[model samples]
Target: MSRVRIFGIGSSSGDDQAGWLTIDALLAAGLQCDDAMVIEKLDRPGANLIPLLDNTAWVILVDAMQGSGPAGRIQRFDQKDWPRYTKGLSTHGFGVIDALSLARELGRLPSRIDLYRIEIGSANPGEQAGDDIQAAAQQLARCIAADLIATLLQA
Candidate 1:
């Protein structure tokens, strides 16, 4: 059972690749995952994400969004904040919130779930992520690393 799990969710698109970038930055920053930690990169996971959390105690999910925010802007939210932010908007065909709701209903959600979304202006497939989006992903990686460190310290 992994105590801490970080999942980067998105496809290989321009802004959609923000999640992948964040995880790549973290790994590049020498993030050492002991047995208790697991880092995964998910592409268009949709409802399949539920099974991935079966053994995870804490979850940090990062993804890109085409919502009402400036491109490159990063938004952080806990599970409780999901209803407020995720309406019917997402760069992917199936939004993250949809999976969250399913997980909640199926009782597969972890106790501590943190969601990070990077606002994207565009996410055309095959295009590389913009500088601003990459910068935001790096920033988000720092924030997530800090949070994970704090959690580890508490335990």
Candidate 2:
């Protein structure tokens, strides 16, 4: 059995509808907590992300990305393709590369780490993103869910 874990690193207050859409997508894809899992942060920062990563064979993260690229553009990443990132990859407290590196060092990382990232045009200075960004993030969530289903069917 393939154990798939999906983590939304931020909260609804910060992530807004993107967080809920992620949960919906997974369930809509007919995936249960037994086959997959989600971390919806309600009152904390970086909540439950580590524990979720610890038990899975594969982790597909859906996060809102900030860039000059077109909105709703979806991109993917694996450990093999992750670049040596600098100061500005994610708006979250921890950089994406650093988070993955920390998980790896702590032996909490999954065997396969895939990122389904969406590029956004604008975002709020704080935790929450702008409306356009949030919409794109939701679309990316759906795409990731579909990708997950396709992967399972192929396997």
Q: By TM-score, who's the top model here?
A: 1
Model 1, TM vs. native: 0.95
**Model 1 misplaced regions, further than 4 Å:** none
Measured on C-alpha atoms, candidate 2 has an lDDT of 0.59
Per-candidate TM equals 0.95, 0.69
lDDT agreement with native, every candidate:
0.87, 0.59
Question: Ten residues in a row with the worst lDDT in model 2?
Answer: 39-48
Task: Pull out the clashing pairs in model 1.
Answer: none
Model 2 TM? 0.69
Q: In model 2, what are the clashing residue pairs, if there are any?
A: none
Q: Write the per-residue lDDT of candidate 2 for residues 19-60, one digit (tens) a residue.
A: 445555556657567545543422223533566577677777
Candidate 2 at residue 153, lDDT? 84
Candidate 1 at residue 140, lDDT?
Answer: 92
Cα lDDT tens digits, model 1, 78-128, are 777898657526876667888988999999999988898888878888899
